[model samples]
Target: MDGFDAHQRQMETLCGRLELIADLLPDQADPTLCKFTSDGIVKTLSDAQAFEEKELFPALQALSLLETDMKEIFAQLREEHYEDLCFAEEVRDNLRAIIEGHPSQSANATGYMLRGFFEKLRRHMAYERYLVSALRTKKAPGTPDAS
Candidate 1:
Protein backbone atom coordinates (compact mmCIF):
# COMPACT_ATOMS: atom_id res chain seq x y z
CA MET A 1 0.00 0.00 0.00
CA ASP A 2 0.95 3.64 -0.36
CA GLY A 3 2.56 5.63 2.41
CA PHE A 4 -0.64 7.48 3.18
CA ASP A 5 -2.64 4.30 3.56
CA ALA A 6 0.01 2.76 5.79
CA HIS A 7 0.22 5.82 8.00
CA GLN A 8 -3.55 5.93 8.26
CA ARG A 9 -3.76 2.29 9.22
CA GLN A 10 -1.18 2.78 11.94
CA MET A 11 -3.04 5.83 13.18
CA GLU A 12 -6.35 3.97 13.26
CA THR A 13 -4.84 1.14 15.25
CA LEU A 14 -3.20 3.47 17.76
CA CYS A 15 -6.41 5.48 18.10
CA GLY A 16 -8.41 2.37 18.78
CA ARG A 17 -6.04 1.37 21.52
CA LEU A 18 -6.11 4.88 22.99
CA GLU A 19 -9.91 4.83 22.93
CA LEU A 20 -9.87 1.69 24.99
CA ILE A 21 -7.34 3.22 27.38
CA ALA A 22 -9.46 6.32 27.71
CA ASP A 23 -12.38 4.17 28.70
CA LEU A 24 -10.53 2.92 31.75
CA LEU A 25 -8.07 5.38 33.19
CA PRO A 26 -7.14 6.86 36.61
CA ASP A 27 -9.17 4.09 38.22
CA GLN A 28 -9.05 1.01 36.02
CA ALA A 29 -6.84 -0.83 33.56
CA ASP A 30 -3.08 -0.97 33.67
CA PRO A 31 -1.58 2.49 33.77
CA THR A 32 1.57 1.37 32.00
CA LEU A 33 -0.52 0.65 28.95
CA CYS A 34 -1.13 4.35 28.42
CA LYS A 35 2.60 5.08 28.38
CA PHE A 36 3.22 2.52 25.68
CA THR A 37 0.27 3.57 23.55
CA SER A 38 0.95 7.30 23.85
CA ASP A 39 4.58 6.84 22.84
CA GLY A 40 3.56 5.07 19.64
CA ILE A 41 1.04 7.78 18.82
CA VAL A 42 3.60 10.51 19.33
CA LYS A 43 6.29 8.83 17.23
CA THR A 44 4.02 7.80 14.41
CA LEU A 45 2.30 11.17 14.11
CA SER A 46 5.58 13.10 14.34
CA ASP A 47 7.03 10.97 11.55
CA ALA A 48 3.95 11.43 9.41
CA GLN A 49 4.06 15.20 9.72
CA ALA A 50 7.76 15.30 9.00
CA PHE A 51 7.31 13.14 5.94
CA GLU A 52 4.42 15.21 4.62
CA GLU A 53 6.20 18.53 5.03
CA LYS A 54 9.49 17.29 3.62
CA GLU A 55 8.16 15.28 0.67
CA LEU A 56 4.45 15.77 0.00
CA PHE A 57 4.34 19.53 0.49
CA PRO A 58 7.12 20.18 -2.01
CA ALA A 59 5.50 17.97 -4.62
CA LEU A 60 2.11 19.62 -4.18
CA GLN A 61 3.68 23.06 -4.36
CA ALA A 62 5.13 22.15 -7.76
CA LEU A 63 1.63 22.01 -9.22
CA SER A 64 1.46 25.62 -10.35
CA LEU A 65 -2.28 25.54 -10.94
CA LEU A 66 -2.89 24.68 -7.31
CA GLU A 67 -0.14 26.80 -5.78
CA THR A 68 -2.30 29.60 -4.39
CA ASP A 69 -4.88 27.32 -2.76
CA MET A 70 -2.18 24.96 -1.65
CA LYS A 71 -0.26 27.77 0.01
CA GLU A 72 -3.22 28.49 2.27
CA ILE A 73 -3.87 24.84 2.95
CA PHE A 74 -0.24 24.07 3.57
CA ALA A 75 0.08 26.98 5.97
CA GLN A 76 -2.91 25.80 7.93
CA LEU A 77 -1.55 22.28 7.94
CA ARG A 78 1.78 23.44 9.34
CA GLU A 79 0.00 25.28 12.08
CA GLU A 80 -1.98 22.18 12.89
CA HIS A 81 1.19 20.14 12.90
CA TYR A 82 2.65 22.40 15.54
CA GLU A 83 -0.48 22.25 17.61
CA ASP A 84 -0.72 18.49 17.27
CA LEU A 85 2.90 17.95 18.30
CA CYS A 86 2.31 20.00 21.42
CA PHE A 87 -0.87 18.13 22.17
CA ALA A 88 0.77 14.76 21.60
CA GLU A 89 3.61 15.70 23.92
CA GLU A 90 1.13 16.67 26.58
CA VAL A 91 -0.67 13.37 26.22
CA ARG A 92 2.59 11.49 26.46
CA ASP A 93 3.56 13.39 29.60
CA ASN A 94 0.20 12.73 31.20
CA LEU A 95 0.42 9.06 30.34
CA ARG A 96 3.94 9.02 31.68
CA ALA A 97 2.62 10.52 34.90
CA ILE A 98 0.14 7.72 35.18
CA ILE A 99 2.92 5.19 34.81
CA GLU A 100 5.04 6.98 37.37
CA GLY A 101 2.26 6.98 39.99
CA HIS A 102 1.85 10.73 39.94
CA PRO A 103 -1.36 11.19 38.02
CA SER A 104 -2.67 14.76 37.85
CA GLN A 105 -6.00 14.57 36.05
CA SER A 106 -9.02 12.54 36.95
CA ALA A 107 -10.23 9.64 34.86
CA ASN A 108 -12.79 11.73 33.01
CA ALA A 109 -10.28 14.46 32.25
CA THR A 110 -7.74 12.02 30.90
CA GLY A 111 -10.40 10.35 28.85
CA TYR A 112 -11.45 13.68 27.37
CA MET A 113 -7.86 14.50 26.48
CA LEU A 114 -7.43 11.24 24.61
CA ARG A 115 -10.69 11.64 22.75
CA GLY A 116 -9.93 15.23 21.79
CA PHE A 117 -6.47 14.40 20.52
CA PHE A 118 -7.60 11.42 18.43
CA GLU A 119 -10.67 13.15 16.98
CA LYS A 120 -8.72 16.24 15.92
CA LEU A 121 -5.95 14.05 14.53
CA ARG A 122 -8.44 12.09 12.47
CA ARG A 123 -9.78 15.30 10.96
CA HIS A 124 -6.25 16.38 10.09
CA MET A 125 -5.58 13.11 8.29
CA ALA A 126 -8.84 13.38 6.37
CA TYR A 127 -7.93 16.79 4.99
CA GLU A 128 -4.54 15.52 3.83
CA ARG A 129 -6.20 12.59 2.08
CA TYR A 130 -8.56 14.91 0.26
CA LEU A 131 -5.64 16.95 -1.05
CA VAL A 132 -3.91 13.82 -2.32
CA SER A 133 -7.05 12.82 -4.20
CA ALA A 134 -7.29 16.29 -5.70
CA LEU A 135 -3.79 15.92 -7.11
CA ARG A 136 -4.87 12.87 -9.11
CA THR A 137 -7.93 14.46 -10.74
CA LYS A 138 -6.78 18.03 -11.25
CA LYS A 139 -4.51 19.16 -14.05
CA ALA A 140 -1.34 21.00 -13.24
CA PRO A 141 -0.50 24.28 -14.87
CA GLY A 142 2.74 24.71 -16.97
CA THR A 143 2.37 21.12 -18.14
CA PRO A 144 1.49 20.05 -21.68
CA ASP A 145 -2.20 20.38 -22.42
CA ALA A 146 -4.09 17.10 -22.10
CA SER A 147 -6.75 18.07 -24.64
Candidate 2:
Protein backbone atom coordinates (compact mmCIF):
# COMPACT_ATOMS: atom_id res chain seq x y z
CA MET A 1 0.00 0.00 0.00
CA ASP A 2 0.95 3.65 -0.43
CA GLY A 3 2.17 5.61 2.56
CA PHE A 4 -1.14 7.36 3.10
CA ASP A 5 -3.13 4.11 3.05
CA ALA A 6 -0.65 2.47 5.36
CA HIS A 7 -0.77 5.36 7.78
CA GLN A 8 -4.57 5.35 7.79
CA ARG A 9 -4.65 1.64 8.59
CA GLN A 10 -2.11 2.16 11.33
CA MET A 11 -4.16 4.96 12.82
CA GLU A 12 -7.25 2.78 12.87
CA THR A 13 -5.37 0.03 14.65
CA LEU A 14 -3.90 2.49 17.12
CA CYS A 15 -7.31 3.86 17.92
CA GLY A 16 -8.65 0.42 18.73
CA ARG A 17 -5.59 -0.43 20.75
CA LEU A 18 -5.78 2.81 22.67
CA GLU A 19 -9.36 2.13 23.60
CA LEU A 20 -8.43 -1.34 24.80
CA ILE A 21 -5.57 0.01 26.86
CA ALA A 22 -7.75 2.70 28.32
CA ASP A 23 -10.33 0.21 29.43
CA LEU A 24 -7.64 -1.96 30.97
CA LEU A 25 -5.87 0.91 32.72
CA PRO A 26 -7.57 0.49 36.10
CA ASP A 27 -6.45 -3.12 36.22
CA GLN A 28 -3.21 -2.77 34.32
CA ALA A 29 -0.90 -3.79 37.10
CA ASP A 30 -0.30 -7.27 35.73
CA PRO A 31 3.24 -7.32 34.46
CA THR A 32 2.58 -9.24 31.25
CA LEU A 33 -0.44 -7.27 30.02
CA CYS A 34 1.08 -4.00 31.12
CA LYS A 35 4.27 -4.69 29.25
CA PHE A 36 2.44 -5.84 26.16
CA THR A 37 0.10 -2.87 25.97
CA SER A 38 2.66 -0.16 26.76
CA ASP A 39 5.15 -1.59 24.29
CA GLY A 40 2.50 -1.71 21.59
CA ILE A 41 1.53 1.89 22.19
CA VAL A 42 5.12 3.12 22.06
CA LYS A 43 5.99 1.17 18.96
CA THR A 44 2.89 2.12 16.97
CA LEU A 45 2.98 5.81 17.78
CA SER A 46 6.71 6.07 17.21
CA ASP A 47 6.46 4.43 13.80
CA ALA A 48 3.50 6.59 12.77
CA GLN A 49 5.30 9.77 13.86
CA ALA A 50 8.40 8.85 11.91
CA PHE A 51 6.38 8.07 8.78
CA GLU A 52 4.41 11.32 9.00
CA GLU A 53 7.49 13.45 9.44
CA LYS A 54 9.77 11.68 6.97
CA GLU A 55 7.30 10.72 4.26
CA LEU A 56 3.74 12.00 4.45
CA PHE A 57 4.24 15.72 5.03
CA PRO A 58 7.07 16.07 2.54
CA ALA A 59 5.12 14.19 -0.13
CA LEU A 60 2.07 16.38 0.31
CA GLN A 61 4.14 19.54 0.33
CA ALA A 62 5.96 18.50 -2.84
CA LEU A 63 2.65 17.98 -4.57
CA SER A 64 1.68 21.50 -3.46
CA LEU A 65 -1.46 19.92 -2.05
CA LEU A 66 -1.17 21.80 1.23
CA GLU A 67 -1.77 25.20 -0.35
CA THR A 68 -4.19 28.01 0.49
CA ASP A 69 -7.20 26.57 2.34
CA MET A 70 -5.45 23.35 3.22
CA LYS A 71 -2.51 25.11 4.85
CA GLU A 72 -4.33 25.62 8.13
CA ILE A 73 -5.45 22.01 8.22
CA PHE A 74 -1.95 20.82 7.52
CA ALA A 75 -0.56 23.06 10.26
CA GLN A 76 -3.15 21.79 12.71
CA LEU A 77 -2.22 18.21 11.85
CA ARG A 78 1.42 18.94 12.57
CA GLU A 79 0.53 20.50 15.90
CA GLU A 80 -1.65 17.51 16.79
CA HIS A 81 1.26 15.20 16.08
CA TYR A 82 3.35 17.09 18.63
CA GLU A 83 0.54 16.81 21.13
CA ASP A 84 0.28 13.08 20.47
CA LEU A 85 3.96 12.63 21.18
CA CYS A 86 3.55 14.40 24.50
CA PHE A 87 0.60 12.22 25.36
CA ALA A 88 2.56 9.11 24.50
CA GLU A 89 5.32 10.21 26.86
CA GLU A 90 2.80 10.78 29.60
CA VAL A 91 1.39 7.30 29.04
CA ARG A 92 4.80 5.73 29.28
CA ASP A 93 5.58 7.58 32.48
CA ASN A 94 2.29 6.62 33.99
CA LEU A 95 2.80 3.01 33.02
CA ARG A 96 6.26 3.06 34.50
CA ALA A 97 4.90 4.48 37.69
CA ILE A 98 2.35 1.70 37.88
CA ILE A 99 4.90 -0.99 37.16
CA GLU A 100 7.24 0.38 39.79
CA GLY A 101 4.85 -0.19 42.68
CA HIS A 102 2.75 2.93 42.39
CA PRO A 103 -0.33 1.40 40.84
CA SER A 104 -2.78 2.92 43.28
CA GLN A 105 -1.43 6.39 42.61
CA SER A 106 -1.22 6.13 38.86
CA ALA A 107 -4.17 3.99 37.81
CA ASN A 108 -6.90 6.58 37.92
CA ALA A 109 -4.72 9.28 36.49
CA THR A 110 -3.63 7.00 33.69
CA GLY A 111 -7.18 6.14 32.89
CA TYR A 112 -8.08 9.81 32.73
CA MET A 113 -5.20 10.63 30.46
CA LEU A 114 -5.96 7.73 28.15
CA ARG A 115 -9.59 8.71 27.82
CA GLY A 116 -8.69 12.27 26.93
CA PHE A 117 -6.04 11.13 24.50
CA PHE A 118 -8.41 8.72 22.80
CA GLU A 119 -11.07 11.38 22.33
CA LYS A 120 -8.60 13.82 20.85
CA LEU A 121 -7.18 11.10 18.63
CA ARG A 122 -10.64 10.17 17.37
CA ARG A 123 -11.25 13.77 16.37
CA HIS A 124 -7.88 13.94 14.69
CA MET A 125 -8.65 10.82 12.69
CA ALA A 126 -11.93 12.32 11.55
CA TYR A 127 -10.09 15.41 10.39
CA GLU A 128 -7.59 13.26 8.55
CA ARG A 129 -10.41 11.40 6.78
CA TYR A 130 -11.81 14.75 5.69
CA LEU A 131 -8.41 15.82 4.41
CA VAL A 132 -8.06 12.61 2.46
CA SER A 133 -11.45 13.06 0.87
CA ALA A 134 -10.51 16.61 -0.03
CA LEU A 135 -7.38 15.40 -1.70
CA ARG A 136 -9.25 12.80 -3.73
CA THR A 137 -11.88 15.27 -4.89
CA LYS A 138 -9.41 17.97 -5.86
CA LYS A 139 -8.74 18.17 -9.58
CA ALA A 140 -5.41 18.91 -11.24
CA PRO A 141 -4.94 22.44 -12.58
CA GLY A 142 -6.48 23.11 -16.01
CA THR A 143 -8.29 19.79 -16.06
CA PRO A 144 -11.68 19.66 -17.77
CA ASP A 145 -14.54 20.12 -15.32
CA ALA A 146 -16.29 16.90 -14.39
CA SER A 147 -19.60 18.69 -14.03
Candidate 3:
Protein backbone atom coordinates (compact mmCIF):
# COMPACT_ATOMS: atom_id res chain seq x y z
CA MET A 1 0.00 0.00 0.00
CA ASP A 2 2.94 2.32 0.72
CA GLY A 3 6.22 2.91 -1.07
CA PHE A 4 8.18 0.78 1.37
CA ASP A 5 5.63 -1.97 1.11
CA ALA A 6 5.83 -1.84 -2.67
CA HIS A 7 9.60 -2.00 -2.63
CA GLN A 8 9.50 -4.91 -0.22
CA ARG A 9 7.11 -6.75 -2.48
CA GLN A 10 9.23 -6.09 -5.51
CA MET A 11 12.37 -7.31 -3.76
CA GLU A 12 10.60 -10.44 -2.62
CA THR A 13 9.33 -11.12 -6.11
CA LEU A 14 12.74 -10.60 -7.63
CA CYS A 15 14.36 -12.95 -5.16
CA GLY A 16 11.65 -15.51 -5.69
CA ARG A 17 12.13 -15.41 -9.44
CA LEU A 18 15.85 -15.89 -8.98
CA GLU A 19 15.32 -18.81 -6.66
CA LEU A 20 13.01 -20.39 -9.18
CA ILE A 21 15.64 -20.19 -11.85
CA ALA A 22 18.30 -21.53 -9.53
CA ASP A 23 16.13 -24.44 -8.57
CA LEU A 24 15.44 -25.20 -12.20
CA LEU A 25 19.11 -25.31 -13.07
CA PRO A 26 19.83 -28.60 -11.34
CA ASP A 27 16.95 -30.27 -13.08
CA GLN A 28 18.57 -29.53 -16.42
CA ALA A 29 21.19 -32.04 -17.58
CA ASP A 30 21.27 -31.57 -21.33
CA PRO A 31 23.80 -29.04 -22.54
CA THR A 32 21.05 -27.01 -24.15
CA LEU A 33 19.16 -26.89 -20.87
CA CYS A 34 22.36 -25.90 -19.14
CA LYS A 35 22.89 -23.11 -21.60
CA PHE A 36 19.33 -21.91 -21.28
CA THR A 37 19.46 -21.85 -17.50
CA SER A 38 22.86 -20.19 -17.54
CA ASP A 39 21.59 -17.47 -19.83
CA GLY A 40 18.50 -17.06 -17.69
CA ILE A 41 20.58 -16.68 -14.55
CA VAL A 42 22.82 -14.11 -16.20
CA LYS A 43 19.81 -12.12 -17.34
CA THR A 44 18.28 -12.23 -13.89
CA LEU A 45 21.53 -11.11 -12.33
CA SER A 46 21.75 -8.20 -14.77
CA ASP A 47 18.23 -7.13 -13.96
CA ALA A 48 19.02 -7.29 -10.24
CA GLN A 49 22.17 -5.20 -10.63
CA ALA A 50 20.27 -2.60 -12.62
CA PHE A 51 17.59 -2.41 -9.96
CA GLU A 52 20.21 -2.03 -7.23
CA GLU A 53 22.12 0.67 -9.10
CA LYS A 54 19.07 2.67 -10.09
CA GLU A 55 16.92 2.29 -7.00
CA LEU A 56 18.45 0.55 -3.97
CA PHE A 57 21.89 2.16 -4.07
CA PRO A 58 20.50 5.70 -4.28
CA ALA A 59 18.04 5.11 -1.48
CA LEU A 60 20.74 3.63 0.70
CA GLN A 61 23.06 6.51 -0.11
CA ALA A 62 20.50 9.08 0.99
CA LEU A 63 19.75 7.14 4.14
CA SER A 64 23.40 6.65 4.95
CA LEU A 65 24.20 10.33 4.63
CA LEU A 66 21.25 11.25 6.83
CA GLU A 67 21.29 8.57 9.53
CA THR A 68 24.14 6.93 11.39
CA ASP A 69 22.51 3.54 11.74
CA MET A 70 21.50 3.68 8.13
CA LYS A 71 25.06 4.40 7.17
CA GLU A 72 26.23 1.25 8.92
CA ILE A 73 23.46 -0.74 7.35
CA PHE A 74 24.27 0.70 3.95
CA ALA A 75 27.89 -0.24 4.39
CA GLN A 76 26.87 -3.81 5.02
CA LEU A 77 24.55 -3.74 2.05
CA ARG A 78 27.29 -2.34 -0.10
CA GLU A 79 29.54 -5.19 0.93
CA GLU A 80 26.83 -7.62 0.01
CA HIS A 81 26.44 -5.88 -3.30
CA TYR A 82 30.10 -6.34 -3.98
CA GLU A 83 29.75 -10.02 -3.23
CA ASP A 84 26.81 -10.18 -5.57
CA LEU A 85 28.89 -8.56 -8.27
CA CYS A 86 31.53 -11.24 -7.87
CA PHE A 87 28.94 -13.99 -8.00
CA ALA A 88 27.33 -12.51 -11.07
CA GLU A 89 30.68 -12.18 -12.77
CA GLU A 90 31.55 -15.78 -11.99
CA VAL A 91 28.21 -16.95 -13.32
CA ARG A 92 28.70 -15.02 -16.52
CA ASP A 93 32.20 -16.36 -16.99
CA ASN A 94 31.10 -19.90 -16.34
CA LEU A 95 28.21 -19.56 -18.74
CA ARG A 96 30.47 -18.12 -21.38
CA ALA A 97 32.90 -20.97 -20.91
CA ILE A 98 30.12 -23.47 -21.32
CA ILE A 99 28.99 -21.73 -24.49
CA GLU A 100 32.53 -21.86 -25.80
CA GLY A 101 32.73 -25.66 -25.41
CA HIS A 102 34.96 -25.62 -22.41
CA PRO A 103 35.71 -28.94 -20.73
CA SER A 104 32.96 -30.88 -18.97
CA GLN A 105 34.77 -30.42 -15.68
CA SER A 106 34.41 -26.68 -16.09
CA ALA A 107 30.69 -27.05 -16.60
CA ASN A 108 30.40 -29.24 -13.52
CA ALA A 109 32.42 -26.83 -11.50
CA THR A 110 30.31 -23.92 -12.68
CA GLY A 111 27.14 -25.73 -11.72
CA TYR A 112 28.49 -26.27 -8.23
CA MET A 113 29.68 -22.71 -8.03
CA LEU A 114 26.30 -21.39 -9.10
CA ARG A 115 24.57 -23.40 -6.40
CA GLY A 116 26.79 -21.81 -3.80
CA PHE A 117 26.38 -18.34 -5.29
CA PHE A 118 22.61 -18.63 -5.33
CA GLU A 119 22.57 -19.68 -1.71
CA LYS A 120 24.72 -16.76 -0.72
CA LEU A 121 22.65 -14.44 -2.85
CA ARG A 122 19.46 -15.64 -1.18
CA ARG A 123 20.90 -14.88 2.23
CA HIS A 124 22.03 -11.47 1.05
CA MET A 125 18.52 -10.75 -0.17
CA ALA A 126 17.18 -11.63 3.26
CA TYR A 127 19.63 -9.27 4.88
CA GLU A 128 18.56 -6.54 2.51
CA ARG A 129 14.94 -7.15 3.39
CA TYR A 130 15.79 -6.68 7.05
CA LEU A 131 17.62 -3.43 6.32
CA VAL A 132 14.82 -2.12 4.18
CA SER A 133 12.27 -2.94 6.86
CA ALA A 134 14.27 -1.01 9.41
CA LEU A 135 14.50 2.04 7.15
CA ARG A 136 10.86 1.85 6.26
CA THR A 137 9.88 1.87 9.90
CA LYS A 138 12.07 4.90 10.53
CA LYS A 139 10.88 6.94 7.61
CA ALA A 140 8.37 9.68 8.37
CA PRO A 141 4.84 9.00 7.34
CA GLY A 142 3.42 11.03 4.40
CA THR A 143 6.93 11.63 3.02
CA PRO A 144 7.42 10.73 -0.61
CA ASP A 145 9.47 7.55 -0.89
CA ALA A 146 11.11 5.84 -3.80
CA SER A 147 9.81 2.46 -4.93
Report the alpha-carbon TM-score of model 2 versus the true structure. Answer: 0.71
Q: Write the per-residue lDDT of candidate 3 for residues 3-48, one digit (tens) a residue.
A: 4445445545544544554455434445554456556654565566
Candidate closer to the true structure by TM-score (higher is better), 1 or 2: 1
Point out where model 2 deviates above 4 Å: 28-30, 58-69, 104-106, 139-147
Cα lDDT tens digits for candidate 1, 19-133: 8888886578476677678667689888888878986676667764363677887898899999998998888888888888887788788889999998898888887777666
Off by over 4 Å in 3: 1-28, 40-43, 57-68, 104-108, 136-138, 145-147
TM-score of each: 0.82, 0.71, 0.59
Against the true structure, whose TM-score is highest? 1
lDDT of 2 by residue, 1-147 (tens): 146667667767767665676687676546655566566766677677677666655545544665476467667777878888788777766666666666545566777887787688778767656655555566456533322
Worst-scoring 10-residue span by lDDT in model 2: 138-147
Instruction: Order the candidates by TM-score, highest first.
Output: 1, 2, 3
Candidates in descending lDDT order? 1, 2, 3
RMSD (Cα, Å) of candidate 3?
4.7
Candidate 1: lDDT of 76? 89
